[model samples]
Target: MVHGYSGKILWVNLSNGEVKKQSLDMELAYNFLGGEGIASNILFKEVGPETDPLGPENILIFMTGAFVGTNIPCGIKTTVVSKSPLTGIYGESIFSAPLGLDLKYSGYDGLVVKGRAENPAYIWIHNDQVEVKSAKHLWGMDTFETVDAVREELHDKSISVVAIGPAGERLVKIASIISDDSRAAGRCGLGAVMGSKNLKAIACKGTGKIAVSNPERLDELRREALNIALPNTKTLREHGTAAGLIVFEQNGNLPIRNWTRGSFPEAENITGSTMTQKILVGPNPCKTCPIACGRRVRVPSGPYAMEGSGPEYETMAALGSLCYNSNLESIAKANDICNRLGIDTISTGQTIAFAMECYEKGILQDTGGVDLTWGNPDAIVKMCELIGMKQGLGAILGEGVRRASQLIGKGSEKYAIHVKGLEFPEHNPRKFKSMAVAYATSNVGANHNRGSPMLVERNLLSPELPWKEPVDGFLTKDKGRMAKVYQDLCCAVDSLGMCKFMVFWGKLPLKILTEYYGAVTGRALTFEEFMRIGERIWNIQRAFNNRMGITRKDDTLPERFLKESVNEGPAKGQIVELDVMLEEYYRERGLDEDGKPNEGKLRELGLGWVADIIHKK
Candidate 1:
C-alpha cells in the first residue's frame, strides 16, 4: 500500500460515462512527485499539440500531491492540468480547496476526465462510489449557487463542489473554476474546457483516513514547521495577500493604468490593510493550513454590498491599480462577481484595463455601453460583469487580452501587455528584474505560480536555497541561475500538493520540505534529489510546450517591458534587460538556444520519451 497517496487513479470518460479505478503507477510517482508533476507527465503523453483545449480531445486531470492527506502543514493544494484554451500550450491551475482534500480521502490520488458529455453533467464522487449525473438543472447557475445546489441535491453539506458559472458555460477564455464558492483554480481558461465538456460541477465527499509513513516523525515535523512557519507568516496572516499594495506602489511594482504608469498614488486606499479595516470578516484557511492567508470578506451594505472571498494582491492590482480604481468596496464587488462568474480576475482586469487604454487612444470608440474612463470604479465593476457574462464588448474582452487585441488592433497590441496569450497578473517585471525571466519562460505564459524568482530577489524567501546571498535586484547578474532554481523548486512545491505560502512566505527551509515528504511517503530525498524531481517535471512541461511549437522566440516578455521604460517612480527609466538573462537562463536550464530542452538534458532527466517526441531523433 502506498503510505501517502491512495495509489488509485479515477479515470472518467465523460463521452461514454465510463468510470474506472486503476492502480497508480508508483514509478511515475517517484519521478514526478504527484500533483502537477504526475499530471503534467500524463498530460504530455495523453494530450498532444493537436488537441483542442475546449474540444472533447483535451483531458482535464486533477492530481493531489503525496502530502495532501498527511500531517504536512499547508499541503492541501491540488493541480489541474489540461491543454490551454487561452495560451494554446501548457495549462495548469493550483488551488487549496476542500474539494481536493475530499479527493484524497475518497481513495484517489488523481482524477482524469476525458471526452464530452452529451448534456450538462457533474461528477459525483462518494468514496468508492462514483457517478456522472445530469447537471442540466444546475447549468445556468453561478459558482456560488452551483455549489449550494449541488450540496442540496446530494443532501450532503460536507460534499465539496468545484463548479463553473456563466462565464465558463459560455466558454469564456478567462473563465476560472471556483471551489466551494471561495477558492479558485484561476488560470489558463480551464473552466472553458470544463464548459466544453459540459461538466457543470464535481461534488466530492470522502470518509477514509490517509495512511502516512513514520506518523510520529510526521507529527513532530509538523509541530516544528508550525513553530517556525507561524512566526514568519504573521504579517501575511494579519493582512492577507494584498498587504503589499502600498509597498508595491512605493517600489513601482504596482501596475497602474494598463502598465503605462509607474505608480498608483491611491494604492493604500484599496489595499489589504484597508480591506481589513473595512470588509475583512476573518481568516479563511484551507485544510492543513496554518498561515490562513486566505481572507473572508464582506461589504456591509451598498451598491457593492456583498462578498465571500476577498480580493488578493493580484486581483487588487488587476482590478484596483491597473484600472486606476482605488475603491476597496467596489474592488470587492468586482472580485465577488468574478468569483461567482468563474472568471480569472487577472485576465479580466487586464482586458478591461487594455480597453480603458484603447478607449483613451481612440482605438475603441465605445466600451460596450459603459464609459471606460480611468479610475472609474463603476466602469471597472461594470466591466467585470460584462466580461464574465460575455455581454456585448465583454464577449471580445472575454476572449482574453491576446485574442481581443488582435480583433481590435491599431497599436492596441502594444498595450495588450501579455506574454503568449496569458495576461500579466499584478507583478511588474521591470520592478523586479528576475520576474522578467520568470514570466517570459513560464510554460503557461505570464505565470507567477510556476516560479517567482522575484520572491528571492526581494529577499522574501528563506536562506535554505544554496544561493541565499543578497541579490542586486536591478542587475541581470545571477538572475538566470535564480530563475532556474526558482522555477524548479516551484515545480517541486506545486507537485507536493502543497501551498507555497507556508514554505515561501513562512520562510521554512528546504530541508523541512524534504522531511515532510520523507515522513509522508518514507521517501527521504536530499535537497538535490528533491530539486531533481522538480527539474524533471519542469523539463516535461517545457518539452510538451516545445512539441506544441514553442521556441526561443515564443519565450519572451511583452514588448512593453522590453521597449518601454517606466519614466517615473522607483523603477524610473527602467526596462527589463531580458536578452542577457534569457541567454544565461537557457544555458542554466540546459535548454538549447531555441529554448527546447536538449536531447541530452531530457534523457539525463529520465525523459528519453520526451526527447524522442520534442527533438527529431
Candidate 2:
C-alpha cells in the first residue's frame, strides 16, 4: 500500500455498468503528485480531441492531492477535470469541503467516471462498497435538495454529496457542481457534462485513514504552518473573500457595467465589512481549514431574505457592481440561487451584465418581457433564476456569454466578456497587466484560480523563488516571467491538494511545502524537483489543449482590454500592452511565438511523446 494515498482508483464506466478498482500506479502518483496533475495526465492519455465534451467519451475525474486526508491544514480541496462543455479545451474546476477527504477515505485516490448512464443515476460509495444507484427521482432536483435527499436515503448525515441542479440537468453551459449545499466546483461548465450523462450526484462515506511516513514531523510542520498562516488569514476568517470587494473597487480591479467602467461608486454598500455588519452569521470552514475563509450567513426576514452561504468577493462583485447593483441582500439572494441551482455566479453575473448592456444598446430588442435594465436589483435576481431554469432569455444566457452574444448577434460579441469560450472572472486585467497574459494563456480560459495573477501582483512572491520583490503591473518587463513563475507555483500547490491561499495569502514558503511532501510520502521532493513537477504538469494541460488546435492566436485577451482604457481611477488610461508581454511570455514558457510548446521544451520535461504528438503533427 502506498503511503499518503488510498492506493486505489475507482473507475465507473456507466456505458456498461462496470465498476472496478485499479491499483494506484506509483509512477502516475509520484510524477503528477495528484489532483489536477494526475487527472490531467489521465485525461490527456485517455480522452481524445475528437471526443465531444458532452459525449460519453469525455471522462470526468474527481481527484485529491498527496497532502489531503493527512495532517496538512487546508487539505480539503478536490479538482474536477474533464473536457469542458464550456471552453471545449482543458477544463477543470475546484471545490472544497470534506469531499476530497471523504473520497480518499472511500479507499480511492481518484474517481474516474465515463459514459452516459442508461437512465438518471448517481454513484454511492461507502468504504470499499460501491454502487451506481438509479437517480430517476433526482433528475430535476436542485443541488441543495439533492444533497439533502441523498443524505436522507443513505441515513448518513456525515457523508459528503456533490450534485447539480436545474441548470445542469437542462445542460446549461454555465452550470456548476455544488457541494455542502453552497460551495461549488465552479467554472468550466463541468456541470453541463454531468447533465449530459444524466448523472445527478455522488455521495461518499469512508472509515479508513491515510498513512503518512513521518507522522511526528508532519504534525510539527502542520503546527508551524497554522501558526504562520492564522495571523495573515484573519481577514478571510472574518469576512471571507468578500474582504476584497471595496479594495478592488478602489484599485480599479473591479469590473463594472460589463467591463465598460473602471470604478463603481456604490461598492461600499456591498463591501465585506457591510456583509459582516448586516448578514455574516459565522465563518463556514472545511475540515482542517485554518483560514476558515468560507462565509455563512442569513437574511433574517425580507423579500430577498434567505441565504445559506453569503457571496464571496468574486460573487459579490459579479452580481453587485458588475450589474450596478449594491444591494447586499439581493446579491446574497442571487448567490443562494446560483448555489442551489448549480450555476457559476461569475459566469451568471457576467452573462446577465452582458445582456443588460446589450439591452442598453438596443441590440437586444426583447427579453421575454423581463426587464434587462442596469442596477435593477429585482432584475438581477430574476435573471439569475431565469438563467438557472433556462427559461425564455435565460436559455440564451445559459449558453454562456460567448454563445449567447453570437445567438443574440448584431455586433454583440464585442460586449461579451470572455476568452475562448469561458467568461472572465470578476477581476479586471487592465489594472494588473500580468493578468492580461495570465487570462490569455489560462488553459481553462480566463481562470483566475488556475493562474493566480491577483495574488502574485499583490507582491505575494514565493520566498523559495529568486524573485524577491513585486513587478510593476503597468510595465511589460518581467511580467512574462511573473506569469510563468506563478502558473508553475499554482500548479505545484494545486497538485499537492493544498489550498493556494496557504501559499499566497498565508505566505507559506515553497521550501516548507517540499518538507511536507517528504514527511508524508517518505520521498524527498526538493524545491527544484517540486517546481519541475509543476512545470511538467502545466505542459501536460497545455498539450491537451494544443492537441485541440489552441495556439498563440487563441492565447489573447479580449479586444476591449486592448482597445479601450478606463478613463478614471488607479488604472486610468491603462490599456494592456499584450504584444511585448506575449513575446516575453512565450520566451519564458519555452513556447513558440505561435504559443505551442516547442518539441525541445516538451522533450526536456520528460514528455517526449507529447512533443512527438505536437511537432510531428
Candidate 3:
C-alpha cells in the first residue's frame, strides 16, 4: 500500500473517449517525487521534438504532490505541464486551489489528457467514476460563467471546476486556466492546449479522505507550521502581495513604462495599503493556507467598476506602472476581465505595453480604432477586452508580443522585451543582477517564479542560506551560485505542492519538509536525498528543452535588457551583465558550454536516459 498517494493515474484519450487507470510506478515516484517532477519526466518520454505545441499530439498533465490534502500548510498547489503554445518548449504552470486535492481524494494522483475530441466537451470525475460530457452549450462562456454553468449542470455546488474562457476558446497564446473563478494557472498558455483538445472544463467531486502514515505526527507538524507561518506572514496577510509596490519602486526593481524607467513616482496611489483603503473586501485564502495573502476586491461606481480578484503586484505593475497608468480601479477591472476571459494578465498587459511603445515610436500605426497610448487606463482596459475576445487588433496582440512584433516588423523586436517568446514578468533584472541569470537560465523564458534570486539578494530570509554569501543587489559576482541553489529549492517546493511564500515565512526548512514527508508517506528521506530529487527534476526539464533545440544561445535575456541601462531612480546607469554571470551559472550547474547536461552529471543524477536522448539529437 502507498501512503500519502492514491497510486492511480487517470489517462483520458479524447479522440475515442476512453478512460483508463494506470498504476503509479513506485520507482519513478521515488526518484522524481511528484507533481511537476513526475509530469516533466512523463512529457520527456511521450512528447517528442517534432510535436506541435497546439496540436493534438501535445499531452497536458495535471498532477498533485504527495503532501497535498494532508493539512500541510500551503500544500494546495496543482502543477499543469505541457508543450507551450507560446514558447514552443517545456511549459509548466502552478495554481493554488482545491482541485488537485479533490483529484487525489477521487483516487488519482494525476490526470494525463491526450488527443482531440470530436467536439466541445468537459471531463467530470466523481470518486471512481469518470465521464466525458458534451459541453456544446458552454463553449463560448467566460471562466466565471463556465464555472457556474458546470457546477449547476453537475448539481453539486461543492464540486471544484477548472475552466477556460473566450481567450482559450479562441486559442490565444496567452490564455490561462481559471479554477474556482478567481485562482488561475496563469502562465504558459496551457489553456490553449485545452482549447485545441476541445476541452471546456474539468469538474471534480470526491468524498474520500486522504490517507496519511502518522496522523499524530502530521498534527504536530501542522501546529508547528501554523506557529511558524502566522507571525512571519503578518505583512503579507495584512496587505496582500501588492504591498511590494512601494518597496519595488524604491529599490528600482519595478518595471515602469515598458521597462524604460526604473521607478514610478505614482506608485503609492495604487499600493497594497491604498487597495485596502479603496477596494479590499476580504481575505481570500487557498486550501490549507495560513498566510491568506490573496485579496478579494471590488470597484464601486465608475467606468471600471467591477468585483473580482484584486490585482497582485505582477498585475499592478503590468497594467498599472508598465503603461504609466495609476488608476487602481482600472487595474482591478483589467484583472477581473483577464480572470473571467482566461488570459494571463502579465503577458496581456506586457504585450499592450510593448504595442504602446511601438505606437509611440511610429512603428505601429493602426490599432483598429482604439487609442494605443501610454498612461491611458481606458485604452488599456479596452485593449485587454479586445484581446480576450480576439477582436480586431486584439487578435494580433493575443498572439503575444514576440509573434506580433515579428508580423509587424520595422526593428520592433528590439522593443518587444521578451526572451525565447515569453514576455518578462514585472521585475527588472538590472536592479537585481541575480534576476538576470534567473530569467536567462530558466527553462521557461523570462519567468520570475522559476527561481527568483531576489529573495536572497534582498536578504529577505534570515540566518542567510549557507550555500552562498549575501551580496549587494547590484553585484554580478556569485549570483550564479545564488541562482542555482534557489532554483533547486524552488523546484523542490513546486514538486512538493508547497507555496513559494513559505520561504519568506521561514517555514520551509529542509528538516521540516523531510519530517512532513516522512510522516505523510511513511518513508524516511534525508535532506540530501530530497534535494537531489529536485536537482534531477531540473535537469530533466533542461534536457526536454534541449531536445526541442534550446542551447546556450537560447539561454539569454532580451537585447534591450543587456544593451540598455536604467536611466532613473536608484538603479540609474545599471545594466545586467548576463554573459559574465551566465558562464559562472553553467559552471555551477555542471552543464557544458552549450548548456547541455554532461554525461557524468546525467549519470550521477540517474538521468542516463536523458543523456541518451540528447546524444541522439
Candidate 4:
C-alpha cells in the first residue's frame, strides 16, 4: 500500500490482465526525478529497438512528477511517454492537471501499460483497485461523447479521463489523446499507439492525499514560486501567446499561403488584440498554473458559434495565416474539431494546408469535388471533419506529411514541410535562426515543446535582459550553444512539471528550482546537481531514439526549408542555412561523426551506468 503522501506505480499487462504494483523506485526517483525523466529511464530499459511503434509490444507510460498534485505554481503538467508512430523516435507529450491530481488521488504516481488487449477495452482505477473493463459499447464514439458516457456510467462527474476520438480509433498517425476537455497529449501520435492496443480510455478516481516531504518548507517555497510566476501570469492574461503574432508578423516569420509567403495578407484580422476585443470570453488555466494562457471563447455570428476553448498561437497560425484563412469563426471551429477529435492542431492544420497547396498545383485532384484554396473557411472545416473521420482524401492526409507526400508524389514532398517525419509548428524559421536549430535537433521531430529558443531570440535578447542579442532570425552560425542551453533548461523545467511560459514572466532561476525540489523531496542538492540530472534525463531520451535507428541524417529540415526562400516580408529571400547550425549543434552536444551521444560526455554527466546505451548498434 502507498503511504507518506506518495502513490504506487501500477504495472498492467493487458494481454493477460495481469496487474501488479511496484514500490516507487527511490533510487531512480532521487536520481532521475519524475514524470518525463522517470518515464525516459523506464522506456530505455523496457522498450526494445525492434518494437514497432504501432505494435502491441510497445510500452505506453502515463507519468506525473513529484511536484504534481502540489500547490506549486504551474506544477500541473504530466508526461505521456511512448514510441511515436509519426517520428519513430522517443515520443513525449505533456498535459495539464486535474488529470494529474486525480491520478495521484487514485493512488498511482505513474501507470505503465504494456502488451495489448485482445479486444476493445478501457481501464478503471479506483484508489487501490484496478479493472480492465470491456469498452465495446464505447468504441467508435468521438472523444467528448466517450468521456461523458464513461463518467455517467461510473456515476462520478469528477472522474478524470484521458481518451481518444475517431482520429485515434482509425489510427491516424497524428492523432492525439485528449484530456480535461481541452488539454491534450497532442503530438507524436500517442493516441494512435493507444488505439493500436484496442484501448479506448482510462478513467481514474482516488481519495488519497499526496504528501510533501517537508510541508512547511514546501509551503514557503510555493509562496516564493508564485511570486516568480506572477509576472508570467499577467503577461499571458493580457496578450495571450498570440501576442507574439504581431512580433512574428513584423519580423516576417508568419507563414502564409502554405509557407510560399512569409507575411499574411490578413494578419490584423485575426491577431491577439482582435480576438480579445471580439470574442475573448475569459482566461482558462491548467491546474496549479498561474499563467492562464488558455482562452475560453464564443463566436456569436460565425460558422463556429458554440462556446468552447479558444485557439492558442500555434492553432491560430496553423489554421489561420498558414492557410490564409483569416476568418476567426472558422479558426475557432477548427480548434474545436482538433480538440474533440484528439489531433495536433499544429500538424493537422499544416497537413490540410499542404493538401490544399497540392490541389492548387494540380498535384492532387480534389476528392468528392472538395476545393483546396487559400482563405476558404468552408473548405477548412470540411477537411477537418474528413481528417477526423478518416474519409476520402483525409485518409491520405491523415498519414502525416512525410507519408502523405510520399503517397501523393510528384515533387510534392518538396512542399511537405517537416523534419524527421513530424510537422513544424506555426513559427517561421526564416525570421529566427534559433527557432531553426530547435526544430532541427528536437528529439520528437519539429515540436516546439522540446525547447523553443525563439523566446530568447525575440523576447529576452534586448538590452534590458541578461542575454545578448545575436543577428536577426535569418543568420545560422553560433546557434548550437543557444539550442543546447535552452534544451537543458527545458528538460529541467519539464522535469519539475513547470510550464515554459513561466520563464518569460517570472524570474525562475536554478535557486528557485533548488528550493522547490528541496522543499518537496526533503533531499537537498546543489544547483549543479539539479542541472546535471536534467542533462542526464535528456541524454537518456536521446539514447532511446538513437537505439530506434534515428541518426544525424534524420536531423534535417524539409527540402523547401533548405532550398526555397520566403517570397515576402522582412525575412524575404531567406532559407534556413541548416548545415552550419547542425554542425555547431552537434559539436556543442558532444556528438561524434554520426550524431550519436558522446560517450565521454555521458560519463562526465555521471551516466556511466549505461555508457553502452549511447553506443548501441
Off by over 4 Å in 3: 462-464, 467-469
Q: Write the per-residue lDDT of candidate 1 for residues 1-617, one digit (tens) a residue.
A: 68888989999999999999999999999778899899998899898878989989899989999888875878888898999999999999999877778888999998999999999999999999999999999988999999999999988888888999999999999999998968889899989999999999998998897898899998898888889889988878998989888898997889998888887778889888888998899998876787898899989898999968888899999998999998999999999999999999999899999999999889998666799889888988888898899898999999999999999988788889888899998888888888899998998999888899888667776666766565767889888888888999999988988888888887887798888888888877888888999999999999899888899999888888888887789888889999999889999999997889998998999999888888875
User: What tens digits encode model 4's per-residue C-alpha lDDT throughout 1-617?
Assistant: 22222647888888999898887888787777788888898888988788898898998998888777767777788899999998888998988846677778777778888888999899898888899999999998878888898999999988988899989988998999988578888888899999988889988888877777777888787777677668646757875777667667878878787888877767887887788888889887776766788888888874677677888888889999888899888898888888888788888889988988888888988566687877888888888888887888888888898899999999899779888888888877877878788888888888878876776766553232235654455667667777876776677678766676765456555577767777777788677777678778878888788788878888888777788887678988888888888889888888777777888988887777667766656
Better of 1 and 4 by lDDT: 1
In candidate 3, list every pair of residues with a backbone clash: none
Each candidate structure's TM-score, on Cα atoms with residue i matched to residue i, is 0.99, 0.99, 0.98, 0.95
- Candidate 4 lDDT score at position 298: 85
lDDT at residue 560 of model 4 (Cα atoms) = 75
Candidate 3, backbone clash total: 0
Alpha-carbon RMSD, each predicted model: 1.0, 1.1, 1.2, 2.3
Candidate 1 residue 225 Cα shift, in angstroms, is: 0.5
Ordered from best to worst lDDT, the candidate numbers read: 1, 2, 3, 4
Candidate 4 colliding pairs:
5-211, 232-505, 431-473
Where is model 1 more than 4 Å wrong at Cα? none
